[model samples]
Target: MSDTRNAPHVDMLRSPLGRVRGLGSAHRGAVTWWGHMLTSISLVPLTLWFIWSMVGLVGASREEVALWLTRPVPLALMLLLLVATFYHMKHGLETVVEDYVHAAAPKFALLLAIKGISILLGLLCIISVLRLGL
Candidate 1:
């Protein structure tokens, strides 16, 4: 029972119960951290592929771009990139809001808005990609 009152940094105010339980109430543990890292790593390759693909599309007509996307591999890869990106973005934004937004109401509102917009726009993009394949 060292005095938390005299603790220099002030973050040492955990209850004995909190210290013992380890996971505490929030309980995300390493999973969220690992997911964030994995998504970050995955984005590197996807982003590079996207940049190259766009560069190739630069001088092309819309019909040529559409034709390129109509291939099975390109269509699949694009969908995977979109899904991973939107999922990663949602988690990252949620983490930012959770860490920075102190007010509960605003945190909840921002999280809700983020999830909603991510899903809506992601679906629209996926649909657009699919249409190009068609």
Candidate 2:
């Protein structure tokens, strides 16, 4: 009984109420993406610096290696590398799990685990670095 040409448009998959209630997409696409990119970009230089520092310490004795870490430059850069790499890894996994894992429960669980483990590992590294400096 309705005129097809004059009918209002409606999204079949998502209801109008859903849109009004803001129950879609989570609006975090750009933030998560940019965080990943920035961390990745930062990691390039940090990783290179770490490798360069390692090369210098390659033939050093245990005490020499410990002395290197006790220095402020190596200590700070190492902590930066730890934090940035962990954050980068966490976000990368989050994007992958979010895209591929469709189930809500599993997706949430995986993200939580990834972030939690990443934080724990990063903290452990930082603590170890600080202990060496102290």
Top TM-score prediction, candidate number: 1
Q: What shift in Å separates residue 44 of candidate 1 from its native position after superposition?
A: 1.8
- Per-prediction count of colliding residue pairs? 0, 0
In angstroms, give how far residue 12 of model 1 lies from its true place: 21
Q: Give me the candidate number with maximum lDDT.
A: 1
Q: List candidate 1 segments past 4 Å from native.
A: 1-25
lDDT of 1 by residue, 1-134 (tens): 77777666755545676767755455645456677788788889988988988898899998998999999988887998898899898988998998899998998999999999999999999999999897
Q: How many times do residue backbones clash in model 1?
A: 0
Model 2 lDDT, full chain set: 0.83
- lDDT tens string, model 2, 61-94? 9789779998988888888899889889888888
C-alpha lDDT score of every prediction, in listed order: 0.85, 0.83
lDDT of 1 at 126: 98
**Residue 61 in candidate 2, Cα distance off native in Å:** 4.2
